[model samples]
Target: MRRFWYLPLWLTLLVTGCAGQAERGDSLYAQLGGEAGVDRIVAGLLWEIAEDSDTRALFVDTDIERFRNKLAEQLCAVADGPCVYSGDSMRETHRHLQVTSAQFNRLVSSLIRVMEQEQIPVGPQNALLQRLAVMHGDIVAD
Candidate 1:
């Protein structure tokens, strides 16, 4: 009888502890400083991309404000935030661009620079990059 009682108690404690750890872990979105933080990071990244001679041409005819908003939405969604990215799929958006691996790498480097400038800790910055890097297949075709 005592063994049975202890079993349930142990299970309950285990579950409770796991739930608390989950809550404490939080989402990457929160770690990235939420929506405002995302905006700041994205803005800095776009600025870097525009100034990077190797990647500037990609945004030559783009509407920067709209791009910023969409990029933020996408980043927020990927970070498990509340935003919904309504932009076209990555493949569809980049299909005609014929983006090369070098170009893609340049953009990623710019993004990393912005993250560093934002003073985002290494863990969260790497986490965000990991999430974004999965889209390389869709964004890089050349």
Candidate 2:
């Protein structure tokens, strides 16, 4: 069986309103280790995916550098950091991938592992994942 390192704090959203989200962005960004910390986590996650055979095929034809930059941007943006995401929407990006639920779950596991490696605290990690959870429908080929 695949070892799944899932979240115990998933969906614990930090903000309840748009104003709150805007206010919490900086705090969340700082909690996520700021730009440098975010960079490290994104890099680690990309590395994790690259090393995992189950998820590696998803990026076989992808540009690692671009993926890294865009993911960093997206994560930063989601955490209410100063970065703007210049990549395509999640649905558009994954439209052709036919990504399975298992693939999506594996990627999330990789992300959790990366966050753990970064020594990120549970609250910020859950907040970040909760924010990104909105994109799940678009990312997964349902």
Candidate 3:
């Protein structure tokens, strides 16, 4: 009888907690560890890209410092963090680069690896990727 009495209270709290999450759903940014996390992700990605032969040639002429800043800004903006992306549009940035689909996939793969190293749970990583995927058309020159 006492266990049954606690059931209703537990149900009430569960419902309230679920409702609160829905209302404050911007936790994705926090889940990524906020600004510091985004910055680390961008840095790790840059290092990965530099070392990965599949995508290294694409950035041969890129100004790395500028690329790093813009990338961090883009990640922050995409994750709904408190930063606006001030970089050029993907099409403009990739213009004249003839980025292959294979290269694009390699970049995505690199990001996944970096996120895993950053200890970002799969869900937030997927959410961020899904959002960023929308820009694929603008990035690949094919």
Candidate 4:
């Protein structure tokens, strides 16, 4: 009977702790200088990927300018910044591509490189990466 009562107390404390941490985490983005910072990171990432021969092939028939713009907007939205993402859903856009996990990992690595270049703090970078990880299932068809 005592153990059952302790369980609820422990669960409540855990929930409250998580809520506090979430609020603190949001402040990290603001400290990093918000939208302008996010844009810089995105631009650098797109440039790096475009320059890489292997990644460039993925966008061979794509309009580079449009792809870059959409990616920036999407990242901004994902980071909880002030931009709206107007791109197609991951499943829809990637359905015809037959992308593999290797391709997805490569793109993630390219983005991480850009984040490092922009000097985004570790916490925000990790937070963003966690969110991106959730999309892997929808993105990598094979």
- What global local distance difference test value does model 2 have? 0.87
Better-scoring candidate (TM-score), 1 or 2: 1
> Which regions of candidate 3 are displaced past 4 Å?
1-17
Model 3 over residues 1-142: C-alpha lDDT tens digits? 7658889889999999979877887577888989999989988999899899879999999999999999988888888888899999999999899999999999999999999999999999999999999989998988
Best-matching candidate per lDDT:
3
TM-score, ranked from best to worst: 3, 1, 2, 4
In candidate 3, how many Å is residue 101 off? 0.7
- RMSD values for the candidates in order, in angstroms, are 6.2, 10.9, 3.2, 6.0
What candidate 4 gets wrong by more than 4 Å, as runs, is: 1-32
Q: What's the CA error at residue 30 for candidate 3, in Å?
A: 1.3
**TM-scores, each model vs. reference:** 0.82, 0.81, 0.85, 0.75
> How much lDDT does each candidate structure score?
0.89, 0.87, 0.91, 0.77
On residues 27-112, what C-alpha lDDT tens digit does candidate 2 reach at each position?
88899999999999988998889898989999989989999999999998998889999999999999999888999999998999
Residue-pair clashes per candidate: 0, 0, 0, 0
The TM-score obtained by model 2 is 0.81
The TM-score leader among the candidates is 3
